[model samples]
Target: MTEKAQNINLNKAKSNKKDEFYTQLSDIERELKHYKKHFRGKVVYCNCDDPRVSNFFHYFSYNFEKLGLKKLITTCYKSQDMDLFSTNNAERAIYLEYEGDKNGNMLPDASDIGIKQLNGDGDFRSEESIELLKQADIVVTNPPFSLFREYIAQLIDHDKKFIIVGHQNAIKYKEIFPLIRDNKLWLGFGFKGGAAHFINKHYEDYATAADRKEGMIRVSGVHWFTNIDLKKRHEDLILYKNYNPEEYQKYENFDAINVNKTKDIPIDYDGFMGVPITFMDKYNPEQFEIIGVGIANSGLEIGIQPYKPEHKYYRKEVQKRGAVNGDLYMMINGVVTVPYTRIIIKSKKL
Candidate 1:
């Protein structure tokens, strides 16, 4: 498993409350900078946040007129108390709609916002939320981490435009990769340094080199996934490394060279090369063409010997080394070893 996959696994094993991380406003600001043009005259829905404290609400409501937004909507899950803020409120659920500052105060205040009670617990899948979704032009929120696939499916099903938060590893999901392959979805200007700090009220926290708070959990591999267009995504990567067999080892299971780092990509090589997932951050679709992943039987798979992960003999061979998940493999000589799931690419630069 890659470091990212392992971190996600550790989070899953330790926290059943995988969906509770609160996104910080600063992170939102950094990403929203590139999508301002899309919000004009558009209905932005924040289905997974509470307007009272949600930065999504604050960001949109505060800049409502400036962004030329037509409307803004926000909803929260069950009103059951998770903390003092969730307490002192009704036990059901609620939703809010704002049409920007009605008065001339230049702020979206109580008078400009509409608050309504919901019949359901405000589950995004509930009919009540679906009705609201139909009225939305764009959706934005950090949804339940564990239910990311389901949440994204709903948005795509509705054909809604959106900007949402998800882990970088989500790129490899069977349902997601096809969209990427077809250019239906792509990554946004990711959180600074491929990591984000979120508010975690349900558990104890510690400090990182980035923050000194106890309630904050720094999630690495966090990124912004969006269908919106941005100039940065088209910026080409400058490569200097030339293909050298001694440095770029060919994987035994696949007929391709293993590039341990993105920067080390061989500029002269015209063939397929397996590179790290981190390469996606600096990836420019106009420059490098993504082919496929390095999975067994994946259409891009190749070797003198075919890959068979389920073969009884192959399973036993991998078991002796360590836990073997769906990650791709590379053999050094005759020894079978796992490599991080690589994004197979046929360089356009070459």
Candidate 2:
């Protein structure tokens, strides 16, 4: 193989290694409880999960009767081996279907669940998995982080409802940003304390010793993304601060005022305001109107102007701070300052 091909394969191997992080059962139960009303008599599929190790499968199976679920379907990717991380050596994969407790044991047993083999590797994008997705009312899983865009696209293409785990950074993706703008997707009640501790045995835990748990990796900025309507999405964020020109700096390229922090968003500012991406966590469609993103290409598409010729000298300084031509920047204290990516929004009430 050529050097380029070898590098591609090596990168894929690294991504697959990162994909092995498992969702804790407690985390699954905590998020699923809020959506209980939507699951009655519905078929739920955990497409990117191994029934052997996936807490997604365990959560639904244990609560099958309680949720009034019609069926629970889980597909294992790339391996039939009973291990935490998939070996990905097997050509064929398997799926399991559990209706409920067959025996009087009130537990999901090997005999009770119907295990079946698949013709292809059980990728969420596989034709076999798509067929199963068509049968599901809800898709819940902690899919491979590297494939989040493709994974979400498939669910959207099939018009399937989903509650899946993903990094918060996915919100800024070109494909994903449009969905949030259109209100087709929103953040679910996220992990406790804005982070999650996922079960993993492969990667080294970088979390502090105080935060580390046995055989688990603490991932900050992870959240549940869902198309399902959530109560949290509708609640208005109570803004207390009043707008002041000194505190809220106007972007030179965009018409929006830049508010450095989400909590510092002004109650009286009715005009366009650019707030940090975390603002989405408390977003309410009824209370706020999402204008457009103030990132590179997204900013340009929304008519955010490029830097003036007179300010050309400061381009090098701004670029060093990671601000490109289309990103919103401002002249702060005679210095060109570029804030992090901001989501432009306007208060419907103000």
Best-performing candidate as measured by TM-score: 2
- Which residue ranges in model 2 land beyond 4 Å of their true spot? 1-19, 80-87, 310-312, 317-321
Q: How many residue pairs clash in each candidate?
A: 0, 0
Q: Write the per-residue lDDT of candidate 2 for residues 128-222, one digit (tens) a residue.
A: 98899899999998776767889999999989999998878789888999999999999999999888887766656566778888887667777
All candidates: TM-score: 0.87, 0.91
Candidate 2 local lDDT, residue 19? 37
Q: In lDDT terms, which candidate is top?
A: 2
